[model samples]
Target: MDWGLVLVLLLMGAFGGFSAGLLGIGGGMILVPFITMIFSARGFAPEVIVHMAIATSLGTILFTSMSSVRAHHLHGAVRWRIVALLSPGILLGSWIGPWIGKQMSSTVLALFFGLFISFSATQMLLGKKPSGGRELPGTVGMFAAGGLIGLLAGLVGAGGGFISIPFMGWCNVKIHNAVATSAALGFPIALAGTLSNIFYGWGVADLPPYSLGFIYLPALAVIATASVLFAPLGARTAHRLPVATLKKVFAVVLYCLAAYMLWKAFH
Candidate 1:
């Protein structure tokens, strides 16, 4: 429990949580690479560091999403019907993702995370929407969409808002509803993803101290606490401001992260 490390984690948590509330992402997309850096610096097993990063990112998402969703719920923005429809498939897909992911190397996972998040960021920046005549999918369609979202989210340690929001928007859901619903979906994604990480990484060698499989308990504690505290504030800010421009700024940040990960992979 180094004080310096605790401070860094707290700062990371605050940023990630605030971003999650504000942009429907910012949790895992932001946390994964930074957490990877920390774990690598600490000299954990190279094969397992990205796994730990993704798992810990998901762990932080658990609290941050709860906090963000509570704020959205207070504003009557969350579509519980949609959440209910999506959760089952999301959970199933999330559960399967880590098992698949555990076979890949840290470098490969990092590269994937970098590319995927960058694509998500590009889509956010574009801010495209389909025509208004379309509507959200029916039960089966929603489940399939949820499954895909959850699997990608689990593999990359994202909250899935980046993809889900766009998907909903394409289906002619209102931006607010889509964002709110995406926040709701983060819960299942994080929970199932964390469970998968635990199971998939169980009994692997050279896990850091205090790790339950890939989920680092100490990092989870510090990051989750700070992220939760800041999430509501971000939600409030979202209510106050127009987010289109902000997303462009965030997109640039995500691209930088992608570039860094690519650098790390090849260097």
Candidate 2:
């Protein structure tokens, strides 16, 4: 094993896990860009690097999301009713997303990821609130909303918080509840997205060793181990911290990452 690479992944996991707990974002927004950088630097085929990064990021979320959500659940923050309502659609959309991604050229996919992250960052920076009196939609409406959230998240390897939190907030759900529910929802998004990526990427040419479809298993292992440990700490901190400040700082970081991805796409 490359010890240097392990160190990098460990650090990434620690930070990503903390973010997952704090933001209910599953850390994929952070992981995808960094993983892409690492893979690109290591001379992995450009065509596969972004996909592998995306898939592996989701794979790590499989562990981190659980740890994060458990801590949030302990805090009585999760809205389980919303999770149940949204899951069926999330599953279907998540699976379809990676399949669609598999058909796109790497450059186009990278462009999409970059643009979407930029949009998410803008949403964060603005910190918009919904008008009062709006309520969450009924089952059919929620399912459709969930599908949209899942699709966008899978395409970009996110946990869907960027969309779901805002949607819930617009419907007058409490912020903490929205965050916790988004964390609970991450598991299903990651599960379907990971499986779909694996299926679509199976037997692709020029893939690096130790790949399970598009996922780099070694990175997944290292990231997941470190991320799970840090996630609870982040969840606890989320209850105390001024989340607005954190979101603004994180937004800046995301903008930078988006810029990097855009540069990579062009090159």
Candidate 3:
């Protein structure tokens, strides 16, 4: 293991974790592209680097989410009832997402990832608040949204927070509460996506050492540990900071990163 690589991984983990804690994001939106770039620069197989990056990101978020959710829960912002309503669909979607991802060509997957990031960036930039409504989404809408979120999570190895938070807000949940609940959703998405990645990549030959399916264990370990320590700090910061301003800045950063990833995907 190169010390440089380890250090880079740790820095990425801290950045990603801190972003999650402060922004109510899943961290994959930032982490995946960053990891892909690092792996590419390190001479990892171009064909597999994005997949591995996404999978490893999802695995890392499993731990990161725990810390984030705990902090949000402490603030009394999580909506457990909503989490219960959407969980089954999210779980099912997570299982199916990786299977779909496995069948796509690497180039196609890269393109898909680029597009997804672009969309997330756009959402962040717009920062449109939902019109207030207190009624929860109907059962059908809840399942449909959860399934969609799950599918995206599995395919992209994200925590689905970028999509989930806004959707919850539109469904009439308060923004802070929506973010908090979305953090809880990360757990199932990560678990299901990790399992799917393992099964989908199982027995593939010539993989990098210590890889479990698409995930790199060393990266996962480094990222997960550092993220867990920082996530609480981020959550606390969110409560104290001007979140609207922070979100705008974060959106700009995401747009820049997304543009870079798209360039990498094509060139």
Candidate 4:
């Protein structure tokens, strides 16, 4: 094991988990690119590197989301009603996401992931609000919305907050509540996605050791360990941080990552 690399992964996890707590995202946006670079440098097959990154990102979220949600719940920010309405469809969509990924060419998947992440970052940077404060939709509509979130999240290994938060905000949900509720929804999205990735990657060729299907357990273990510990800290800091500044900084970083991935895909 590369202890140096392990330390770096720990650092990334800490930051990622903190962001999850602060921003109500699952931290996969931070994890995927770095994980891919690490796997690539370690000589993993190019075809499977992105899969490993995505799978391990989701697996790590299984733990990080729990820690984040607990902190948000204690603050009474989580909307249990929203969670209930979105969960069933989230479960179904998440379960199918990795299956779709595996069927696509790795390069194509990377391209799509890059474009999607860039779009998400652009949304944050623009920080647009809906002109009308419409109420949330009916059960079927919420279910459909949940399905879309889950599918996109599964495809890109995110917590779905990039979509969910914006969606809730458009519906006039308070920002804090939207963040907390998105954190709650992240678990089912990740859990179902992770399980599906594991099953989907079984018996695949060129997979690295210590892997469970598409997931690399060592990365998950190291990242989750640090993320779970620091998440509460991020949650607490969310109350004090200059969020607009932080979001801008984070958006810059995401844009860079997106550009890098897109360059890699086309080059």
Candidate 5:
């Protein structure tokens, strides 16, 4: 184990966990970009770095989401009924997402991830809440929505909060409930995405040692451990902090990451 790299992953995990807890984002947005930079710095193969970053990020979210959602559940904020309704579709879509991603070149994958991250940042910066005059759709409709959310999140290595929160709010779910429910939904998205990515990345050439499919095992383990420890603290802070202001600051950081990915994609 490289102690230096372990330290870096620890710090990233701490921050990512806090952000996951506070923002209901499951930390993938932050993890994916940084993991890309780290792997690139380490001279991982260009063909595999982006895929590994995405896969590892999703794997870490498996732990982060569990920690964050447990906190949210304690607050009685999670809408389990909705989670049940959406998960089947989320699973199906998430499974397909990585398969599609595997077919894209690194440049194209990075470009796509960058674009979506920028869009998510813009939404955060604008602080635009979807109008709330409707109720959640029927099971079939929810399944379709879940599929779309899961697919996009898998592609970008997000927690599905970017799409799910807005959709929930649009359907008149309260903001707190939306955030909590999104956190709960992250598990299924991550589970399916991570597994699918692993399957697709199996037997790929030039993979790093200790890599399980596209996931760097060391990074995933370290990050998930660190992220889990901090997630509850972040969840506690979320109710106390001026989250709107924080979101703007986080959005700015995301813009910088997006710019980096764009540069990576092109050169």
Candidate 6:
């Protein structure tokens, strides 16, 4: 393995993990675009690059989510009841999402990826706070939302926090609690997405060595290890920093990255 590539992966992991911790946004918004660039630069088959990027990003999220959730739990921020309520649907949806993704053409997936990123960035910039007065959604609604979130998670290789946090907040959950519960959801999302990717890409020809289906194991290892180690630190920093300012800054960065990704996809 090239040390240079390893270094790049580590840096990507650190940035993505830190952003996840600080903003409660899933790392996929960062990881997917960066990984796509890496794969493209490495001269991988254009047809397969997006799939590999999404799959690898999901695999890495498994570790980062564990670390982030644990950190939030330590601070008593996690809402276990919410996690329990939403997870069943999330798990099932996550399992099915990648399967659907596997059927889509690469160009369509790239466009979807760009649109989602832009939507997430707009949400962040709008500065919308959780409604904060109503009860959690009913069982059916919760499950439906979870299923939708999971499907997106698997298809895009995200932790689902981008959707989960906002959805929880809309249900009148506190912002902190919403983010905490979303963190817990990440584990299931990552697990289902990873498994689906494995099955979806199995037996495909001309894949790079060291791949487990669409996932690149070496990249996953380097990113996951580094991201996990630093996640707690990022969470701690969030407590001290002015989060609104951070959110705006992060939103700008996301927009820039999204633009670059769209450019790459087109040109």
lDDT by candidate, in order shown: 0.87, 0.92, 0.85, 0.90, 0.92, 0.84
Q: On residues 171-191, what C-alpha lDDT tens digit does candidate 5 reach at each position?
A: 989877888898899999999
User: TM-score of every model?
Assistant: 0.98, 0.99, 0.96, 0.98, 0.98, 0.96
Question: Model 3, stretches more than 4 Å misplaced?
Answer: none
* Candidate 1: pairs in clash: none
C-alpha lDDT of residue 133 in model 6: 75
> What range of 10 consecutive residues in model 5 has the weakest lDDT sum?
126-135
lDDT of 1 by residue, 196-230 (tens): 99988889898988999889999999999999999
Better of 2 and 3 by lDDT: 2
TM-score of 3: 0.96
lDDT, candidate 2, residue 166? 91
Error of 3 at 140 (Å): 3.1
Candidate 6, residues 39-140: lDDT per residue as tens digits?
A: 889888888888899999999888888898888888888899888888999999999998998888677788788888888888988879655576678889
lDDT of 4 at 46: 89
Each candidate's number of clashing pairs is 0, 0, 0, 0, 0, 0
The segments of candidate 4 whose C-alpha lies over 4 angstroms from its true place after superposition are none
**After superposition, candidate 1 runs with Cα above 4 Å error:** none
Better of 1 and 3 by lDDT: 1
Q: After superposition, how far is residue 168 of candidate 3 from its true place, in Å?
A: 1.0
TM accuracy, model 2: 0.99
Please list all clashing residue pairs in model 5, or write none if there are none: none
Off by over 4 Å in 6: none
The residue-by-residue lDDT of candidate 4 on 1-267, one tens digit each, is 789999999998998899999888789998898888888889899899888899999998899989999998998999999999999889998988999999977798889989998998998888787768599999999999999999989988999999999999999998888988999999999999999999999999999898899999988999999999988887777667776677788888899888877875765
